[model samples]
Target: MRFCMMESKGKRGVAASRDGGPWHVLFESEPGFPGTVDEIVRSGEGAFEEAMSAIEAGTAINPDDLKFLPPLTEAGKILCVGLNYKAHVQEGGMPMPTYPTVFARFNTGLIGHNQPLVRPTSSEQLDYESELAVIIGKKARHVSPERALECVVGYSIFNDGSIRDVQMRTPQWTIGKNFDGTGGFGPYLVTADELPPGCKGLRMVGRLNGEVVQETNLSDMIFDVATLISLLSEAMTLEPGDVIVTGTPSGVGISFKPPKLLKPGDMFEIEIERIGTLCNLVVDEK
Candidate 1:
C-alpha cells in the first residue's frame, strides 16, 4: 500500500490519492499516521488489513481532499549513499567505490514533493540528483545482507539538491547537499512487498522542466540496495523511520562539459518506476 502525510483541516495525516486528485485522509495527528504506518509495518503481512476494512465500509477518504507533506515527518536521521551508480562515478571523473560511500543529512534539509528548493545567493552551482530513498521500519545493526530486507519499511523518491561550488570548496560534500530545503523526499512510501525483488531493473529518471536530463536503471548500481543496507548496519544502527538515499545517476550539472547549474525559477522532477514522481521548483533564497 502507498502511504503519505498530507495536510487536512490544518493538521497532518496519512493519505493516498486516486486519479491524480486531492489527497484522502487515512489517519490523522490524533490517530497519528506515522505511528499507524509503523504499527502496520510491524504487523507484517497483515498491515493493510485495517485499511481494507475501511474501504469495504465506505468510510475511506478520497485522494483529492488533502495537501502533501514529507512521507515521514520525523526520521531519526537521513543516511545517504553516494557514487553507487557506475554512470555517476564515470561522469564525475571518479572511480567506482569498492565499498558504499556514505554521508548524513540533518532533518532540517527535509522537504516534501512539490515543495520549493531554495537557490542560495551564496552559491550559483545548484544541481539536482534523483535517487531512491529507503525507509527503515525497525531498528537494525550488524545485519546480514540476507536479513536486511526485513528492516525496510518502504521506498520513496529523493532529489538530493546540491551546490557544486560549496561541495567542491572542501573535500566533504555535507555543506553543499545539506542546505535547508535541499532534500526533497516524499509523495509516499511503497512497501517492500509491493516492489520487485532487489528493486532490480527499476528505472530512475530526472527531468529539468519537461526535458529528460538523466536516466538510468537500478541494474547499473555498483552496490545494490541489500548490500548497502548490510554494509551500513555494520557501522551504525538503522532505526525505524530512518531514511537511506540511494545514489543518483549521471547527468548532474557538475558533470557537464562546462557544468550547467540551476538558477532560481528552474523546476525539476524525479520519477522512479513503481514509486512516484517528486517535482520541485527552484526559488531564490529569502
Candidate 2:
C-alpha cells in the first residue's frame, strides 16, 4: 500500500492508495484512526495495519483537495549516507569508504512534495542530490545484513539539497545540510512489500527544470540498503519513523567543472523507479 500524509479542512489526515489507484482519505477524528505518520510508525505494526483498514474505508477525495506533507513530519532521526556510490565518491575525490559515510539532517530542513526548496542568500552554491529514503518499522540493534530488511517498513524519495559553500567550510557537513527548508522528503511512502527487495535494480534520477542531471541504478551503491541498516544499527538503536537516506549517485551540480547550482525560479525533481516523483520549485529564502 502507498501512504500519503496530507492536510484538508485545516485538519491532518492520511490517504492510502493501492498501486497509485484511487486515494482514500482518513481524517484524524475518525474512530481508530492513528496519529501522524511519525506517530503511527512509532506505534508499530498494529497501528499501520489499523491505519490501512481505516483508510481503505474512508472517503475518496480529489488529490487536489489535499495539501501534501512529508510522509513523516516529525521523524525521530534523519540519518543520511554520503558518498555511498562509487561515482559520487570518485567525483568528490574521496576514497571508497569501508563503512558508510554518514551525516545528520534535522527535521527543520524538511519540506514535502510540491513545496519550494529555499536557496539561502548566504550562498548561491545550492545543489541537488537524488536519493532513496528508507523508513524503519521496528526497533533494531546490532541487526545482521541478512535480517536488516526486516526492520524497514517502507520507502520514500529524498532530495538532499545542499549548500556546497557552507558544506565545504567545515569537514563535518551537518551545518550546511541543515539549512531551513532545503530537504525535499515526500509525496508518498511506498511500503516495502510493494517494491523489490532493497529496491535493487531500480533507476534513480534527478532533474533541474526538465533536463536530467543525475541518473543511476540502485545496484551501483557501494553499500546496499541492508548493509547500511545493519552497519548503522551496530552503533545506535534504530527506531520506527527513523529515516535513512541512502546516498545519491553521481551527477550532482558540484561534480561539474562549472557547477549547475540551483537558483530561485528553478525547479528540481527527484524520481526513483517504482516510487513516485518528488518535485519542488526553487525559491530564494525570504
Candidate 3:
C-alpha cells in the first residue's frame, strides 16, 4: 500500500492512493502527516485496515485530486546512519565501521519529493546521497535485532543532501547537512509488507538529471536496517514518527574524479525498488 501527504483546500493532509486517486483522508492539517499516521497506528493496526475499507467503499476521494505532501512530516527526530554502505565508506576514504555510525538532522532540513532544493550561499559544494529511509511505527528501546522489524512502518527514498566543503571543514556533518530543504525525503511510504523479507537484495539507484550516477543494492549495507535500529534503540528511545536514513551508496559528487557539486537548476532523482522514485530540482536561494 502507498501513502502520501497532500494539500487540499489550503490544508495539507495524509492520503492513500488507489485507482490513481486519493482514497481515505489520513490527515487534515499541514505538517501533521506523520503525526496522524502515528495516531492511527497507535490506536491499532486495524485503523489502516478500516481506512482502506472505507476507500474501497467510495467513501473517500480519488488521489489525482489532491496536492501531495512528503510522506512524513513532524517526525520527532530524524536519525541518520552513516557509512552503512560499503561503497560509500570506501569512496569517502573511511574504513568500514565496527559499529553503526550515526548522526541527526533537524526537521528544518526536511522536504518533499519534487520540491526545489535551495542552494545555500554559504557553501558551493552541495552534493547528494541517495538512501533508503525507514519510518518507525512503534516506540522501541533496547529491542533485539530479531524483533526490530516489528517496529518499522515502511520505507521511502531519501536524498541526504550535503555541502561537502562545509561537511569536511569539521568532523561533524550537522552544519553542512541541516540546510533548509536540503534533505529530500519521500513521495510516498510503502508498507513493510510490500517489500521483500530481509530487503537485502533490493536495488537502489540515483541519477543526476537523466544520467545514472549511483547504483547499488541493499546487499552492500555494512549495517542492515534491523541491526542498525536495534543498536540505536539501545542508545535512545525510538518513537513513532521517528525516521532512520540507512545511509547512501557510492557515486556522490565529492567522490568524482574532480569533485562535482550541485548548482542552481540541477535536478536529481532517486529510485528504490518497491518504494518508488523521488525527484527534485535545485534552485538558487531567494
Measured by TM-score, the strongest candidate is 2
lDDT winner: 2
Write one digit per residue (lDDT tens) for candidate 1, span 1-117: 677766667765566543344444545534324344544555555555565344233225654445667877667778888898887898888977998888888778878877898
Name the regions of candidate 1 deviating beyond 4 angstroms: 17-23, 27-65
- Model 2, CA-based lDDT: 0.90
Candidate scoring better on lDDT of 1 and 3: 3
User: For residues 1-286, could you state the per-residue lDDT of candidate 2 as single tens digits?
Assistant: 8888898778889888876678888888987566778887888877777877778888988755678889997877899999999999999999889988899998888999998999998989899999999999999999999999999999999999999999999989999998998999988988898999999999998999999999999999999999999999999999999999999999999988788999999999998999989999999999
What tens-digit string does per-residue lDDT give for candidate 3 at 1-286?
7777767677666667544444666444422234345455454455655555543443376655666566767788889988887878988889889998788988778788778887887778889999998888888999999999898877888999998878878888888888887999888887777787547789999999789999998878888889988999999999877889999888998899787678888899999987789888998778
lDDT of each: 0.77, 0.90, 0.79
Query: So what's the TM-score on candidate 1?
Result: 0.88
Off by over 4 Å in 2: none
Which is the better candidate, 2 or 3, if ranked by lDDT? 2
RMSD in order of candidates: 3.0, 1.3, 3.0
Worst 10-residue lDDT window for candidate 1 reads 51-60
- Measured with C-alpha atoms, the lDDT of residue 145 in candidate 1 is 87
Model 3 residue 181 CA deviation (Å) reads 0.9
